[model samples]
Target: MHDDRFQLPADADERTLLTCFLDWHRKALVRTCAGLPDEQLRRRAVPTSNLTLLGLVRHLAGVERWYFQGGIAENYPGSLYTATGKLGEDFDDLDSATGEASFAIWRAEVETSRRITAERPLEALSTHVITGQSLSLRWVLNHMIDEYARHNGHADLIREAIDGQVGE
Candidate 1:
């Protein structure tokens, strides 16, 4: 498949590195679902797991809103997919999931996240969404990188299971 992710610079400032790495992981996740039909993207390829590419996209959309918009910006609208305020709904409630809509929401949230990050300095702080403790933009960026990295691993396995494709 053709990968269009940004390349990590050998040397850069902290902010550049963090944002670029996060973006890299984000693109990697999308790469995992590339060229698959909506049905294939929504298939729980793993026999015993509920995970799907569409579900991952949905989950990350909520996560992008939760951390950047809610945790950092403090707007705190609420969950994107979960209506009853329950967790994992983004992944579990996917009977009607569509690749077009899921990807659109995800891309919009990611763009919002990028805008929020650009407006704040690395040291800027906001109240944590769950704990109400203070959190820095740096921490949120790092955490998001880790979050996407972990989920990208899951996406890789799911993609491989679906079509025998591999490599990030």
Candidate 2:
């Protein structure tokens, strides 16, 4: 908790620091999604956008899958949701029953990503799908830290709009 290097300790090694961010991001993600009503989860804060808290949950799950499963493992389990831009389309209004499923998928992706990261060496190189270029596991993990942190910020705004909830 005392660490300040992007949620990590200044004394920690590069790998450990990156791991800290990864851990922070996963926890932050869950916190952002917690305790929201179905109606609020589906409500779009922006007047001209399709983004909603529930959709963000699904989107981040997909983001984890595509990055770790598809890009890292080279075998993604397909997508749980498509690129739909309709409000309330994500998880069919984020009701309690369906919210459980959404949480399940998000939880699964977190576990999968953790396993992948732990099993692979930090210096190990893998092919990047979008660029067809190679990058070390270290690089991707660092990038994911950035990715999750950015999305969590977006999530903060959306969650705040839902009921004025704020902070982790």
Candidate 3:
């Protein structure tokens, strides 16, 4: 039996490895809402702002885009505002015009980031646009993995409350 995971090396540096893990988990996170009831997708299951599961999915998509495409991949050419100039408030929009616009922005970012990862080797380092520091492909990959894992935990509680589905 074999277990397949995204981490490149068993003894790899935490930042590098976690980036891949985060990417996988984020993928899983987005998939969490797949095929769910539209009303449920639009409903906020928790007490936070208006973060519906669908909203989270869109939000993460936006985040990945901004991070990979905007920051690392594109280096933030234009503006990076998801919601009223607040990045985290992205999910708070809850399918509003801002949400819809951000969703499109996020989707574009994800697609561009995916292309970047596919084309570039993980060993190659990408410079953070604002920081002017080089970040290895491996590093960002792990970062994304960790980010998704954390949020998915939040999603777990929300989804379970909405539909009794949990884990992963």
Each model's backbone clash number: 0, 0, 11
How big is the positional error of residue 124 in model 1, measured in Å on the Cα after superposition? 0.3
Measured over all alpha carbons after superposition, the RMSD of each candidate to the real structure, in angstroms, is 2.1, 3.6, 4.4
Q: For each candidate, give its TM-score against the true structure.
A: 0.91, 0.81, 0.70
Error of 2 at 13 (Å): 2.1
lDDT of 1 at 90: 80
Alpha-carbon error at 104 in model 2, in Å?
A: 0.8
The candidate maximizing lDDT is 1
Of candidates 2 and 1, the better by lDDT: 1
After the best TM-score superposition of candidate 3, give how far the Cα of residue 4 lies from its true spot, in angstroms.
Answer: 3.9
For candidate 2, lDDT tens digit of each residue in 73-93?
777676667647553354443
Order of candidate numbers by lDDT, starting with the best:
1, 2, 3
Which regions of candidate 3 deviate over 4 angstroms?
A: 1-3, 6-23, 77-83, 95-108, 130-133
Tell me the deviation in Å of residue 28 in model 2.
Answer: 1.3
lDDT of each: 0.88, 0.74, 0.64
Candidate 1 clashing pairs? none
Clashing pairs in 2: none
Better of 1 and 2 by TM-score: 1
